[model samples]
Target: MVQNGQVFKILVVDDEMSMRELLEILLLKHGYDVRCAESGSSGIEAIRSDPPDLVITDIRMEPVNGIEVLKKCKAVSPRTIVIMISAYASTELAVEAMNEGAYDYFPKPFNNEELLSVISNALRNRGEEQSVSDSREGLLYFGCLIGESAPMLKVYETIQRVAKTGSNVVITGESGTGKELVARAIHRQSARRDRPLVIVNCGGVPENLVESELFGYRKGAFTGAASDRKGLVEAARGGTLFLDEIGELTPVLQVKLLRLVQDKTIKMVGGTEEIPVDVRIISATNRDLERMVMEKTFREDLYYRLNVLHIRVPPLRDRREDIPVLARYFLSKFTKDLGKEIHKVSSYAMDILCNYEFPGNVRELEHIIERGVAMESSRIILPDSLTLSMHRRKEQERTVPAVRSEIPIENFDLDKHMAEIERRMLQQALSQAGGVKLKAARLLGISFRSFRYRLLKHELATEDELKEE
Candidate 1:
């Protein structure tokens, strides 16, 4: 590989001498043209003097920081890829770096294999970006999703590979992560593109009616069965059946679904006939089905059958690099749809979007952009037009008074006190919402997943507690 003349020049910037030496040795062993800088100032100078293909910089440095280095690199060499590293990594710092155009971020004491993989990916992506730039085309878009971020590129690759296969697929991700869009993409790319793509919201169906909804029922099957009805499975013959929120299927429904998945046939309610169906199964869930299987809530056989091929859609916060492109894409789409004259998003608005932790993922971002487009009177969207949840969070944060008590700082346990206060507030919210998690989350002005995570963190609600509510 080294003789093939594909080596990439890499620059490592760290305040510690040992770190610089270690990274240089590691990169050199891998047949790379490696350079090292012991300070952020020197790294900036080197970048301006002779830009490398990639720069690996420590976030915490003297006189200048990694964020500054990343800014300088972007300004001097727009094509150069920069990866930020730090022993002290926070969501805020990571968001800042990504918004400032860092290629990726990694915490200190990183795994060798993972770092190597990231470096290889960064080099490969640099080539792809250069090619796109040469052609004057925008970011690579697959179906409804538009992104050139590494995570999104991987997702696109996976979709292309799996689309041609007949294997069952399980798409896992947080809610509003476009799991359905992925299912549609797979169907559009598959051999069954011309055929029906039936979507069944598994959670929306009533438990008592799920069986009949999935399997056709005879005219006299039940009290309300005035006419015979074909089920979602039969409707999707020779096509794809996308089961959204598969985890919501009860144990009995899971067993029935498992049998259908295993046999490719369904038996209708009050019907002795076993109707064969030719369809691909693609299921999506936001819940942890593995834990559910272990807990005996979901069937293990069903889980395995649905998980023949898995695609995980990464949450939006993890792929902040794609926010600008996505925001622009949404802006264009909504403008045309709504017949607005909006042409672009202001840099300040884009920065706000990039810094936000989108608990609702891509769907939330799209909604925000749509709202912004609708609200904006001018061609450009400003920061005020973009009403994000983070703004609400900031307002809420400002309302809380500072710690003012007759207690010494050394003797006071501020963290513990805050935890107790949070726990009590959550409990009160749940009580006020009548133990409904969604309502409680809304009452708290937070996302349901965020509320659920806090509930898990504080051990506030057991499975049984949730069920009872």
Candidate 2:
């Protein structure tokens, strides 16, 4: 039985002495209890005697190859993680290993860091799998989003049910909960899979310019409108028009949008002709449109039109079961993209991630993992590698009280103090909004562009900071 913080026992099975020795030394250096077997048959004997927590085996062993070793390991101890290594890596072999339940496949001449990362991830996953109930083991993935929790399962079901329909969809969720991904999934699964999915950020466009941006302008529609421009609605002609941050649209634009939704037609900003658009509307927002309707901030008619087929995505905290899986998914993604060797988040780091309130949701988690992968020199991302906003919030909470007690009226710098206040407020809003700049701006009663400017002014966070949220 593995104890918390105790070294994990790893079995290395390889006919090549150098490979076995190298892995043994590496595991030992990393504080793992390492054992080596010269052949697959010996490895199986060792497993039968006492199964280690993980097995690393090379393919092409004389009588018993890595595949057989993997099978025998599973037969002996189902919980043990088996990783296959091969000098001649092929698509077929990789698929075979995965089909046979290998934790991961590593090609020969694999980067040492990458190998270690994969080992760490496998071990972590094994631990998680052991703890998780069998019913919750299988997670369904749609494009980029991954989850197996009940809420996510329901979401998957809803997506499958509604994807084939032409009903307008309204996806509501806390920012970073992957609303856009859901929209794309719907479009992909829908009959319009071949057509373009036109996207328009309601909050990203200027208030004065949104109308023209959504409903294209003819030449001379405005001072800068020198040529006929196709609006987003027209651009989406036979496909889907994804309206992100739908609640950010001005009241005037909302009325215009209501018309488009009611009658699949759009009038160009300057042109008199009403162009018929054959687009399926899919809008997403983090705002409560119903509440906005009650307050008269959002038109009730528009809200009704857009809410025909609603999908409310649960926040990250609401689906904690998915964190470990998502973390590993992101770890694999960033590691491969960066061409880095980092493979896994340490169990401690994973705990921290799973426990921390991800105000920015999946997007925030992705940023955290990306940073961890970039900064971590070791294969495993430990707790220290994670720079959680919760820590920063705690520090702010501690320091604010002290500052309040110590401030003097005589030596006050209003400019600096106000700027600091603004920065802190912005940070708090971002945290509350789950690292979504548009949502943060809305929380602050400001425009998205202004919020961006403030972020730049304060050097607080970057545009990349709110990526995909």
Model 1: per-residue lDDT, tens digit, 120-189? Answer: 8557756556567535333544547677789988999999999989899999998887899899999999
* RMSD, candidate 2, Å: 13.8
Tens-place lDDT digits, model 2, residues 151-253: 9989988988789898899999988999999999999899998999998888743454568768988898765566888877888889999999998898889
Clashing pairs in 1: none
Instruction: Supply the global lDDT for candidate 1.
Output: 0.80
User: What TM-score against the true fold does each predicted structure earn?
Assistant: 0.57, 0.60
CA-only RMSD, every prediction: 13.6, 13.8
Clashing pairs in 2: 117-343, 359-434, 360-434
User: Pick by TM-score: which candidate is best?
Assistant: 2
